[model samples]
Target: MLSFAHINNSIFAKSPPFRTAAKRLFHAALSQRMKIIPISVLEDNYSYILVDDKTKEAAVIDPVEPSKILNVLSQTGAKLTSVFTTHHHWDHSGGNVELVAKKPGLAVYGADARIPEINYVCKDHEEFKLGTLTVTPLHTPCHTKGHVCYFVLDPATNERAVFTGDTLFIAGCGRFFEGDARDMYRNLFHVLMRLPEDTWVFCGHEYTRANIKFALSVDPHNEALLAKAAWCQDKTITVPSTIGQELLYNPFLRVNEQALKLAVSKSDPVEVLNTLREMKNSFR
Candidate 1:
């Protein structure tokens, strides 16, 4: 049994030397003119197209099929400069080889070496350019050891969207396939949750409806969650959930709530999370 007391031994327990907020995202990054186009594929998978309308340059995140991505590129009239792989999962990386084959010298950035055609290995806080916009790769390794979330920022408009592969979803998170509760705790709270409050959450799957169902069962009385659940029923896709919005309703993000702790009969945050994960696994 993994205990919450040993949290520091997990992958993200050690704090990196991150720059101060003012220096990290300079004041100029407020006027970015980028558009996030969500491509629906493989039943519930999502591939995001980040396009710089000004430069006509773009990057694809979590591409699973080439034809689908290609159609978007053709429609947007944007040239593909790179592919950002969030993890080693087939659903997120299946189109890497084909995209690389179609567009030569197209960089594939990922923390996982297992990601197919990964030519650009991303390091923590590694920044790259997609048609003049800045993309920072945040290493959040709970879903899979090398899972990363791409933070796309427009320096001019200061607009942002995080391409969260399977690490963090809309109202839920990825299953603990490679790591444990402690690792997930840091990934969700210590790392990703610390991003700017208004950051757009562009996750890898369309699992909001199901996630909300489970979320309601656990955090049943949240008004924001209840409203969001009602809204989800009428939509085919639920994404671009803001960080501020997630903080209000996501059960995974609210493990510290007194209600959640009591419902799971756990005192420690990690233990509560583990209990939540176990319960949610069989929720249906």
Candidate 2:
């Protein structure tokens, strides 16, 4: 299991105040906009802090613990505007109450009406703004029925980052808790795969090492899968894989791959997904 103790220290070290001042002066001198600061949270879950260097306004995504998040905000001196919850799971949404208590009237957004302390209930494709940052909510309900992923488009860089909360991961997809293989297939292949190839994928959880092990079992002939597993072992760090990379190496994503199709003994994509998921569950 991964430890989260280091997360709080890392966020404080990269606080917004330091970045904001530095970015503002740099932007003014160079006539370029500042890049956003992303803070990883929990064991593998990432709770991003999108700060507007021009305005010092900020928003947080899927805060698992409020104390650590609030500490980062306090150190950074960034005004907390809103909280985005990807799902109702305790690991993702447990900090909602305390966070709202700290920042009264703060809007907490989630697709599930069941999310605790949700101030703004969002739907698929609903758009919201925090400072200059615009986020679109995509309702992806495979891990859980109301699970949502937030896609952010930075106006300055035109870069995209998808905050996939539990629905997707580095090399594997989430368990079929509230949904099934078909639900995951559409979410992973249809929705997420449609994004730009370079889009950075920030998923929930740090299961890459274990996920890749399962991936190799399903598709032993994949050279890329073997290499990635070795790389992950060497780093002693969780691999933050991209959507494009997952497409190439993840058996769950590559349901159409011949090796996976043969392993599952099914030509259908959905059946392949089911087989891959069951295989992952059985993996040590």
By lDDT, the best candidate is: 1
Tens digits of per-residue lDDT, candidate 2, 1-284, equal 00011232342222212121221211223321223334556666666655655566777878777777776667545788888899999888988888888789888999887788998888789788877767899889979899999887778667666888888887888999999999999998888998887666777777888888888787888988887887777433343456777788888888987888998899999999998888788889
lDDT string, candidate 1, 1-284, tens digits? 00000011111101111211122211233333576667778988988777787898989898898887787678656888989999999999999998888888988899888999998999999798888789999988878999999998888777777888888888898888889999999999988899998787889998999999999888899999998888778556566677888899999889999988988888899999999889888999
State the local distance difference test value for candidate 2: 0.73
C-alpha TM-score for every candidate: 0.88, 0.85
Count of clashes, each model: 11, 0
All models: lDDT?
0.80, 0.73
Root-mean-square deviation of candidate 1:
11.2
lDDT of model 1, residue 222: 94
Model 1 segments beyond 4 Å from truth?
Answer: 1-32
Residue 55 lDDT in candidate 1: 95
With a 3 Å backbone cut-off (N, CA, C), the pairs that clash in candidate 2 are none
